[model samples]
Target chain A: MSRSSRTFRGTYFSCMSVQSVSRILAVAFCLVSACTPQQEPDQEPQVRILELQVPANFPEPEKVMAGYPLSEEGVELGRKLFYDTRLSGSNTISCASCHQQQLAFTDGVALNKGAAGTPLLRHSPGLANLAWMNGTFWDGGAKNLESQAFGPITAPDEMNQNLQELVSELTAVPDYVASFRLIFQDEIKPAYIARALAQFQRTLISANSRYDKYVRQEPGGKMSELELKGLTLVQQKCGSCHAGDLFTDNGYHNNGLDSDFSNHSYEGIFQGRYRITHHPADVGKFKTPTLRNVLVTAPYMHDGRFATLEEVLRHYSQGIRASPTVAAAVMQGAEGVAGIPLSVEEKQAIIAFLETLTDYEFIQNEKFSSPFN
Target chain B: MYRIRRSGFYVAMLAILFLAACKEEKEGPAATTSVTVSFQHVVGSEPLQLDEVIYTSPAGDSYAVSNFKYFVSNVKLISSAGEQIYVEPESYHLIAQDGKTSFELKEVPAGTYQRLELSLGIDEELNHRIDHLGDLDPSNEMVWDWDTGYKFLTLVGTYTGQTRSGGLVFHIGGDTNYRTLALELPQPLNPRQDGSSQVLLQANVNELFQGPNLIDFDVMNSSGHGSGPSLIAENYTSGFITVLEAK
Candidate 1:
């Protein structure tokens, strides 16, 4: 193929010629032939509809395919954009820099540094089943996935990329220009970039864990007695917050991580949901994360303070600090002692059950892997 | 799925049917005109000279405005016969001090309009998404990425207060802070078919700090991401903008 035909530049020149010819023909046709009043601006581009299926074992997505419907081409374009480091200011970091497919999307670190080498205030959370979530981030500030992508991509501490500059850079690449025009039917813009990313992130579904198989009674679904006991204990203790089959109620709760929220630094990063809502009762409250692939997505909590599941369980059992907004369920412990009292063996059993929650299939899935690789 | 257009014969027939259906309910003259609303920014009686002129606020604070940008949307013109003509498709506009000062309400029914109603900010439905293009584009820096909303008004400058003096930033946004301004035109606007009429609107910058809540720059110099936006929104009701003339 000629280089001209390979790029959208060729299409642009052809379109201009087509418009000139149509204008001349329009006048001539008006004199000779009857012309239709319906004016077709341009030929409609082809797009294939992709229906997103919810797993039978999982609940219906809280926001199931509403705005910006999914398309096969759009999702493929999104996957490429998700791994493209061109999104960052220095062209050194992408969304995949922190959200790796192997680690179930999280960066397996307490606090991942940004493209600028500054330590981010919060830990990178795993991205799976995000379609079921109403809000994103620790504070639930961003309303949806499309809006959430902007926070990291534009934040000076994160990607540090100027959105207009990013658009210009993307426009330079013919492949991106063609794909974006085909998918969005408009020139490359930040809103379309975010929509494409959200579409790809929504496809990061991780529901094939052993626990999920056990619940669905699928093959290889057997669990050890200790794991079953741990599952029961989790249902009794941690189920209120990390509630249903998705392993999260998707609600904000003050899990008694800190007593003092005086840290107004970075626009009240330590204050949690209160920073967004400004409600006094929401101080130190963070969104409940799904426990799927918890074994690999280590360094738990919003700040990633706990390194192991054992430490997380210990925090719930003994290390829960007293706060004004401590969850009512956690405060329902025996005789004013906050948190669910778990013995050493119970903690071990819970860890084993959490191991069952890890979906190796999702981590090893080549579909969600980088397009560049 | 992409829509494949029907043959020319079928399209012509469909167009005829559609126009016939639309004509049954419509009683006005079929001709349409455009209305141009122009905004003139000023500090009291003086024309706003961005980054050059220093103006005093109601709180007696001297401030030099470096930037002033705001969104005006959902424009409606109330006709003398009580008919309302709403500007559609692209009603949202970002009026900046340095950028375009006016926008045309296209395809308006040629008639006499006595009042103009327009929202000062984006509606709750469109404001939260931040995915819209043109005017509502997130690249304009009017959007709050972390909070997932648009800043209705942004007035950035330097101020010299009595006790404290530094940068002055009054960024007002949020659903609660979205205010609508209804202006009674000085005279009836008669936009004839195939022609246009201009509505001269004046935006007084000093009114931002001269309302029911007199904003002292020393006390709240840089605020709007929190509870401060609603207080600044109250300033809209106190003659921040007035329809100077309708010609």
Candidate 2:
């Protein structure tokens, strides 16, 4: 091939004969005719009908990524894997072990234990409206739910499973293998597992709260006079960091939890956004936990430092501790004071308002429940 | 099991058919060459040694690396003829201390490549794409488990004034303001007739504490995945990348 191309390379392209052009045209036509496929009996690949809605008022997922769209099969498979303790190294824990569906997906404890009852550093976060969350985890590590799945699954203090070995184990299970084939058409790998798990997590939409209904002007969504007053105060005072409909600005802040910037590792000390960005000002910062399930997802804060909404409001009243990286918004409130001062009546009213954000349907959703049980 | 076995049989048959066809008509190694790039983490003239005090910065900050690793990805080779050959999907790699730093360019078009363009960290697309595998695999100590991005470069060491018992941890890699490093080195090379060549690259660690933006570890001997004015992040961003040889 090189010898023939080399011999004609210099002069063959510069000149063309009429007969040669006719011959080339004839050959091209013949090739086109020869390559035409006959209409034969064909088996069309099955297009699985996926019923995934992005939920009302929630933004559409940036784009359903190529190849891994949110499908029912994928979500169901994910649900099964989420509850399957086989994904854990000790075969004792699963995602549902910490993120139970009953507690609005939170483990409802300060720092939840992992596979051998090892203490996990941060509180097991409640998972809801995660489809809108651009980042994952308390420190906002793991990028997205897919990559985030790797964290707890492989962490020594968590489920503690080798991903490759997990894949092999899943392959040994016929149900898992069949389920994986239904969604992925490819063999079970860490990628498929992550995709399936992410697919399931994204469907944990919690938008039917009383607060949402009240905003949507639906029946049974009416707020009390005190709750209405609480809403006004929430918008005026707590809207900066816990801003937007999702009730989180989705950014990192040093919320005055710790004065010192010292941590054992990069992601530890709950380094917050700084751990992700490697910036010094990010020390002692953590992602603002979503207030969607605030009432139910108790034991609050990244470290579960606050046990109740009253404690949380009281802390906010004191304002954040003096730290170099304390969020500028946390330093003052609607009253322009260091902390957001609330009268006892006002605190009770706001707590009432926060309760309206809870959705009973979300915690008890059958779709997100374990396929195993 | 039956499905896997049948698929394997089909794959073997296709491989045999492809080999026969290639032997019959194909030529010139498919106009591509596999290139190996070895990144030598160095301090001064010798190779950088980890957990041992064999190096000192120009600023007199005596240090020894306990751990050092960085990502080198988004590799592209630009020829004199303005041709761009990219190492896609698998372009992202981890260059860790006592780990594999040799990156393979599986199918860089075999030709005279004048300038080799690369990033010293995972690109924003891959970093943000949550479901990536292979080198971006989470097991690799390359990922920042808390944040959404990869720690583009991590150099941990026992230094003169490290307050933390662990040591001085210099972690730099971000998509937002901190940004990934785009290293475009003028590399002239011709792949061997066998379609393989070794590209030598150097990463000088002293550049972090000795350059125009020198780090004063006396007052601050540590930086985590947090934000602050890091002279080390500033100096190390552009100073560490150097192509020793492209042949």
Using TM-score as the measure, the top candidate is 1
iRMSD per prediction, in order: 12.7, 11.7
**lDDT against the true structure, each candidate:** 0.84, 0.72
lDDT per residue as tens, model 1, B110-214: 678898988899888777677667888788989988888899999999999999889998888889888888888899888866455889999999898867889
lDDT of 1 by residue, A1-373 (tens): 2111101112112324677867755655553333445646565566687777898988888764344678898889999999999999999999999999889999999999997787898999999998899999999999988888889999999999999999999999999999987887777988889889988988888989999899999999999999999999989989999898889999999999899999878778889999889899999999999888999999999999999988888888888888899897677576878877888999999989999999999999887999998
What's the alpha carbon RMSD for model 2? 10.3
Binned by DockQ into CAPRI classes (incorrect, acceptable, medium, high), candidate 1 is: acceptable
Candidate 2, residues B1-247: lDDT per residue as tens digits? 9999999999897566445444522352366567788888888776888886557766676778889887776666666665544444346678886889797776555677776767666656667754556677655666655455677778887766434233677777666424345444456677664646877888888886756676766655665434532556676666767788877
TM (B chain), model 2: 0.78
Error of 1 at A219 (Å): 1.0
Q: Give the range of the ten consecutive residues with the poorest summed lDDT in model 2 chain A.
A: A2-11
